[model samples]
Target: MRSDVQQQIISIIAREAVLEPEDVQPSMTLDELGLDSLGLVEMIFAIEEAFDISVPFNANEPAQSEFDISSVGAIIGAVERLICGQRPEIVA
Candidate 1:
């Protein structure tokens, strides 16, 4: 069962990907969802608005960013951490 936050995130990602929410899986990556750079940015914006939290994401250098965008599950975990006032580990 998905938590409210998970469901909301899935919906946001689904909207950005033009897919049904059910089709968005936790294991799926943004690339697998066919999200280009612009789509990724938009999704991030949606996430920020939904959670009312600032996401430490650098669209230009996502790989080096502290927030993980490696997969849907990772994104959810990052958001959860932020919501709890915890910063994600700094990626070196």
Candidate 2:
């Protein structure tokens, strides 16, 4: 069962990807969803706004950023951590 947080994150990603929220999956990568650099940046902005938290993401160097963007589940986990006032584990 998807938590409220998970569902909200999926909705944000789906909007950016021009997909239905149900079509977005935790295991899916943003690339797989056809999100380019611009789309990715927009998605991040939406996430931050919706959650009322700052996301540590750098579109140019996503892999080097503190927030993980490797997969949908990673993003949700990171946001969840942020909402709980915890720092995200640095993605390696």
Candidate 3:
């Protein structure tokens, strides 16, 4: 995994979610971080802006499932896949 990318994502989430760095675990879900739907949307947009990439949003396909975005690690993985132009797997 890309440690720098992971760290950048963790920093963004921690700052935006108002959570401690240690609290941002790899397996912790976004809901667990207290981010609602709007927060999630904002987070995604922030990520896109930060990385200068577009995250494909397909209404029919549901690019990312709720379960897939549960943790800092998962979120980083998703971003990496997006930057690489690959769809993320919905893995919990």
Residue-level lDDT of model 1, residues 1-92, one tens digit each, is: 99777889899999999999999999999999999999999999999988778999999999999999999999988888887774333211
- Winner by TM-score between candidate 3 and candidate 2: 2
Better of 1 and 3 by lDDT: 1
Worst 10 residues of 3 by lDDT: 83-92
Q: Candidate 3 clashing pairs?
A: 29-70
**lDDT for residue 13 in candidate 2, whole number 0-100:** 96
- Return the top candidate by TM-score: 1
Give the Cα error of residue 56 in candidate 2, in Å: 1.0
User: TM-score for all predictions?
Assistant: 0.90, 0.90, 0.72
Judged by whole-model lDDT over C-alpha atoms, candidate 2 comes out at: 0.88
User: What TM-score does candidate 2 get on C-alpha atoms?
Assistant: 0.90
Q: Number of clashes in every candidate structure?
A: 0, 0, 1
- Tell me the tens digit of each residue's lDDT in model 2 across 1-92: 99777899999999999999999989999889999999999999998888778988888888899999989999998889887874333221
- Note each model's CA RMSD in angstroms: 5.3, 5.0, 6.0
Tens digit per residue, CA lDDT, model 3, 4-33 = 667778878886788876678888877789
Question: By how many angstroms RMSD does model 3 differ from the true structure?
Answer: 6.0
